[model samples]
Target chain A: MTSDTALSVVFGDKISDEINDRVNSLADSLKKSGIKGITELCPSYCSLTISYEPDIISVNRLKRKINGILRKEMSVRSEDSVLWEIPVCYGGKYGEDLDDTAKLLGITPQELIKRHSQTVYKIYMLGFLPGFAYLGGMDSSIAAPRLSSPRKRIPAGSVGIGGQQTGIYPMSSPGGWRLIGTTPVDVYNLKREEPILYSAGDYLRFIPVSEEEFESIKLQIESGTYTYKSDEAVRK
Target chain B: MIEILRAGPLMTIQDGGRKGFADKGVSQSGVLDNRSMNIVNILLGNRKDEAVIEMTMAGGDFEFQNETFFALGGADMGAQLNGAECRLYTVYRADKGDKLTMGYAQKGCHGYIGFSGGIDVPVVMGSKSTNIRCGFGGFEGRKLAAGDVVSTGAPVSGITDNSYSPETENTDEIRVLLCAQNYMFTQKGIDDFLSCEYAVSANYDRMGCRLEGTAVEAVNGMDIISDAIAFGAIQISSDGMPIVMLADRQTIGGYAKIGAVISTDIPAFVQHKPGEKIHFRAVTLKEAHKLYRKEQKFLRKLSEKCQKGR
Candidate 1:
């Protein structure tokens, strides 16, 4: 955002772990710096656009403060990243596009599920709709084109593939993603203080479940007795 | 309290909007016309961030449940009270059982209704703005519907004689600061962008406004690493048309943007309805900041005058 709003700061140009780390580190530093007038910060793949109160702090002075922070040796903060195991039911009514997507990708329904559930994805960033995490590391074999026309309401927890990427729709939204499964968990529970389930730097692995199991999990969640299964993991 | 007798197509509770939640992908969904929202708020002597009812195109009927002071602003929607004419941009009293009705807007796209205090609604994620897409915040995380009842807080101050009439501009030209993947556009395309006229398409909302105009050729291609989006960013899609991102814009996007509309002009810019003509002008970062500071000063002075009864 440097040449743009005089409020945004771009760390790099492309998507790489090194660049993203720098972007995240800079955002963390800004948050802890107690730099007054900083209102909001949107961290993207390789850039950070900060929204601040113009009346409280001038752009020139804010730029000076950022420059001062950049000079310091920064570290990527990911020690506390959690590894969440998400359960999904991968066929029938839960996944409307499963049969069509498997046919388009030249794979059997079982094979599609196997490939999708095997990969542990890294939550690169949270964006689009609330709790919608843009995950990396989708298998090329499972890739499929998006719908020609987006549906008006894709239900929350529908796992879908769009091009070479895949993600979960934490809430109902109009989208073109090809749905392959449905998760029983409410990844974005508005009733809770923090609506979003996973933050950037967290890792999540999908576990295929039977439709019966999905119903059981759904019931448990409704009863508020389902505990989120997660494990401690070191940043690689 | 006020009961909505007829809720229009798009009526939502909005304030100054939330901050510091961009990391969770929440959009800054606030009032589209801040200038008018401020005008009504000032006339009623409410906090600048007080929540108000934002109506699009047509303002539906509202029945007063109690006696209170209220003001109207933004595009005049031909407001009437109890079958009589009701003025806009002025604070007026409404008695119990009074019904306020507004026909379609004759001037601007959005119309704002402000109370003496502010709409009493629980603030979620730090703001009262309704994020309709994400489905949270504001009044029950949704738009106001017919039969919906809303309450207002105690009046912070009394109404005054001070009034505001915005200095109208004849031209529809909007200034943009070219940055963030702007280099992808060719010099000739940039020239065409500055000189060309665009028509606002019917497909418009709080999310964005699409324009029908000359294609802005992107020599480096339209694809870019997804990056954070500003409120007024003009993203040139693969088809070459520019979409002006607005209050309900996504946190980040991958499309290449020519530039962002300066902050001061967003209110005036959003007032242009569908099929309206639009022009572009280039400005430096310094120039945009200077203009922003001037608007800030004007608002501050107006707020002080409204409070001091000057």
Candidate 2:
């Protein structure tokens, strides 16, 4: 709809090229206003969420203040890339739904894996759970919808694709995403000084590692000695 | 310490609630009637955020295993200590082995029982609240049942005072802030939402209350992406019936939230039992903010009066 409706709603309308101009600028404007009551400022794919003290600024007033900031033009940066190579083991016990997804797309499991790792995905948002990144730019050939009924529990670091989105389960919790592989990355570690392994806007590449390497990385991650490698590779 | 002889429906142990763990998918599950719970805690002179017992529908019988002070608030559940009318909003001293009992609620659904010190349940995820969803926090992460023994951390410094005051049971109406998704419905749907009296369905619990009301039309192919949801958020299900989520609401939801009840009006809703008919009215955000501040001021003054009068 219009910016009027988007200004008031907490979950604004989906991101579009038209609103992209406004979305790109709102971040800088918020910082410039010197607004004081907020505890956190988290920007996502299209919307920005500001958590404020209820005693200071009422919810309604906060909405109005944010709308004022939206009017300003923000500096847009196009060239930004931080490649993260995540080690994944595809089509095994960790990915129980791999065969089903491959059958749905009329392709072999190995072919599905090839297509999945072929494209570099963009971290669109991080909202479901802590460190659970919603990656965009998936290969549409392997695109699939989420499970009709969500599984009771999906293990942490279980990589799954739902519709055009692909993400790793940050924690062992109930989810409906279609699992294709398991990552050795500790996406969220509560005990660690810096919990979230990957922040939003980072590019990710899946490097298919063997089961033995997966186990070795898991122990290293658990023992607090896992050193992630970030090698650059141009799109081929 | 007190021993539960008989507990009513959905009695649970509660405290300040689990916070700062939302990233872990755990919701803050504290007392539903936070204001009343705070009042009872103030009367007992315990830590305002200390764990207490929250009973629903009807209260139960208990025996004071130790000589200590306790208080009751929230619902007008006629309570008795040694068969005598036990007044609320004031601390009462019960001797060791003294039997105390409570009758069916006359006004509200949930009530609070606060001891001088506090219920000393092991904390889980930085709270003593009993989250039934994940079976975490409070008395081994479960509901209070018959023959359950609830102990306190330490006795609070308070004496029995006849100067206790009670709350005026108010069920006028619930105030709400219209949500953004409200426009998804038609004008008639909005009118029906504010005018039609909804009955609290029997399917009520700490998670949410499924309401039975006028059947509104659910727009065809209307899909809502998962978003953050708070307590007292009225989410319209696919069937167009309203469901008011409570303290144990999920962190995020995919349903269309028509409106969120004003924060201060939560206690009023919590006091309502199943089958109770209540009407909702939309108020300007300005009015909501003013009312919230006014309520806070009134509570502070009332509490001060209670302390001085005692």
Candidate 3:
């Protein structure tokens, strides 16, 4: 599609598992093509935006190259996807809005936590902030709306629900999502080589934990000894 | 080296920007006015991607710790070097202990100050531009403050005392390319967006420029599935006010975008201050590309001339 300096290739008009998979596979193929002048490839829920240097390659030529690549069939292997199990502490000072959110959903705090942790969620994309993943797949029973008024600061590692989706905040910032829990793991670390923990095709599962367990995990993370659990068998 | 005596408003070190990081949710945070920043760097005979100090509105006091050449571009901030008035788009020699001071801008919103060898800052994530939101690049990923000491590399040799100024053109109408979601807005809404003059809102920042004018409401609503956003994407919020995303914009957005500002006109748009009125003119993608190629040719010729002067 027409844009200022980039060409946006939209796979679908809505967010779905098939659309996300197509977008991811297309991004992989484009990266493998070794196309020159492509400065950045940004993938979202249903589209991939290619930013390139106009001086190196004209837009028409780039479009033709991409179209030629798209004609070939490509598939992402299941082993390439990683599923991370993140430990979260719910219902305390860290999750101040947990009770209110449960009340709105007409469920107890324990039930809400159980339902949230039971299902695995897929990361649609990373945006809003660094390392912050836009996740999909939440139980309709615990679906809740965002706060009417946004808080000035939402602490890092906060797990919140907005509309029908749930996600975590990699860093502290202003937000309006209803907080349900907090994770002890560092989803984003600037000192790390990759910085961000999850990618577009990654999966995340929330595991409920106690306050003591959360503190212990935090200590291990700070001491540089914590290891994240990943399941590589899960395929989309 | 240079010591900041008074850091006024917001000042940050920036280069061309951190590219190839949008997938990780990182924005291309760089100078707001690309043309002006490039002009200052070219005038100082520095590399195109050399880091420079970007001052917003007003400039601060800086004491030169070493002898070097410096150039000013973009907004006219009423700069003075050791009690002598300095002209815009011209390079000047600064000796040790010379204090450079700049007042508030007479016009425009941002200014660029470039040294002969450029400012010295560690490159993080493949760039020296400060990602203020993430707090990781360009001088500890924060704005310049008083008492901060910044260093510079050795100046380039064989540079003559020559300067070039770009022709001043009054920019009131900016060109925009209709995007994929242009159909989301009604025909009347699209007409209103192009016909009306919108005033730059006071809530504008490096991330985006919010406009206050006739609300261009979508036929259904402004909600859309989150999609990739680019620099100069005009996203109409739920309230119907359009916000033009900038260099420091988020990589993705959920609002519907009617169009994107053309690259050739982005420099002029970014230099506008709050309360400034501007109109949008729709141009075909082919025309926009032609204009971009013409601008690049001019810049290449200018660089060649500067090299000859050296």
Each model's DockQ? Answer: 0.55, 0.15, 0.67
Best by TM-score: 3
Q: Which fraction of the native contacts appears in each prediction?
A: 0.64, 0.03, 0.69
Candidate 3 CAPRI classification by DockQ:
medium
TM-score of chain A of each: 0.90, 0.76, 0.94
* Docking level for model 2: incorrect
Model 3 misplacement above 4 A: A77-79, B160-162
**What is every candidate's alpha-carbon RMSD to the true fold?**
2.5, 5.0, 2.0
TM-score for candidate 2, residues paired by index: 0.79
Q: State the displacement of the C-alpha of residue A37, model 2, in Å, after optimal TM-score superposition.
A: 4.9
lDDT tens digits, residues B110-149, model 3?
Answer: 9889998888888888889998987878888999999999
Model-by-model lDDT, in order?
A: 0.85, 0.73, 0.88
Cα lDDT tens digits for candidate 1, A183-222: 9999988677776877776788999999999999999999
Instruction: Assess candidate 3 and give its lDDT.
Output: 0.88
Candidate 3 at residue A227, lDDT?
88
Task: State the weakest 10-residue window (summed lDDT) of model 3 chain A.
Answer: A72-81
iRMSD for every model: 2.1, 6.1, 1.3
lDDT of 3 by residue, A1-236 (tens): 54658889999988788888888778878887888989899999999999887778888899899888788776572457789999999988879999999888888999899999998888878888988898878888888878999999999999999888899999999999999899999998877778788788788999999999999999998998998878885864
- Model 1 DockQ reads 0.55
lDDT of 1 at B63: 94
Give the lDDT of residue B308 in candidate 3. 88
